[model samples]
Target: MPSLDTAKAYYEYFNQKNWDGMISLLHPEVRHEPNQGEPRIGLELFKAFMQHMDESYEETLTDMVFFTEPNDERVAVEFVVNGIYKKAEEGLPAAHNQKYVLPAAAFLGFTDGKISRITTYYNLPLWIKLVSE
Candidate 1:
C-alpha cells in the first residue's frame, strides 16, 4: 500500500479500536512519539502505550487529511480528535467521562510498506482545559 493508504489504514484501525490491526502495519522497531513526551521504541512498547491509552480514554479521528512525500516514504495526517476522558492518567487532570475535541496531526515514516515511525502532535493545554472543564 502507498504511504498515505497505510496512514489512513492505521487511523481506521485506531478508530475501530483494533489494536492488532494497527500493530500489524508497524515495523518491529517502530518509534512512537506522543504529543509531549519522549519517543518510545519497539512494537512492544507501542502496544503497551496503546493499552494505556485505551484504558484511559476513548477517541475517534475525524476531518482527516493525509499528505505524502514524493518518494512515498513519509505521510502526514491532520485530523480532529473527539474523545472522552474515561480514566485519570498520571500528571493529568482527573477524568470523569469528560468530552473534548481538538485538532491534531501525525507524521508517519514508512519502510518496506511498514510504518517505522509515528510522531503525533496536539495542543496538550487545550486538551487539558477542555477535559478539566
Candidate 2:
C-alpha cells in the first residue's frame, strides 16, 4: 500500500530539506497538531508553519520505525530528531546553532493519495534542556 511508502517519502523529503517535496505529499485540507501548540489547519497554514520551522531550525529524523493500522488508514512513526537551533522562534531561549538529539513520534492519516492529518509528540522539557546547555 501507499501508506508506508508515502510516510517514508515524507520523512525522506524532510531529511533532504526539500520543503516543497514534503508539502507536495500533504492533502489539501491537512491538519497539523504540534507537540506543544494549538492545531493548525489547511495546506496553506501548514505551509506557513513549515516555512517558520525551516527558518527557525534545521533537523533530520533518524532511527525511524513505522507502524500502521490494518486498513492502512493511519500510520505512526517513531524516530529521533537530530536538530540544530538555527534561529530563535519560540521564547524558549536564544539560539546559536545549538545541536540536540531527542526522541519523537508522529501519527499520520492518509487521504486522496496524500497525508491528511499529522500529529506529532516530543518531550518539550528535554528539548529545552538540551538546547539550553
| Candidate number of the best lDDT | 1
What lDDT would candidate 1 get against the real structure? 0.94
TM-score of each candidate?
A: 0.98, 0.96
Residue 75 in model 1: lDDT: 93
Q: After superposition on all CA atoms, what RMSD does each candidate show versus the true structure? A: 0.7, 1.0
Candidate 2 deviant stretches above 4 angstroms: none
Worst 10 residues of 1 by lDDT: 1-10
The models' CA-based lDDT, in order, is 0.94, 0.93
> Which regions in candidate 1 have their CA more than 4 angstroms from the true location?
none
lDDT of 1 at 22: 99
Q: Which pairs clash in model 2?
A: none
Candidate 2: clashing residue pairs, number: 0
State the lDDT of candidate 2 residue by residue for 1-133, as single tens digits. 4898999999999999998989999998999999987999998899899998889999988999999888878999999999999998657988999999999999999998799999999999999999999
Candidate 1: tens digits of C-alpha lDDT, residues 103-133:
9999999989999999999999999899988
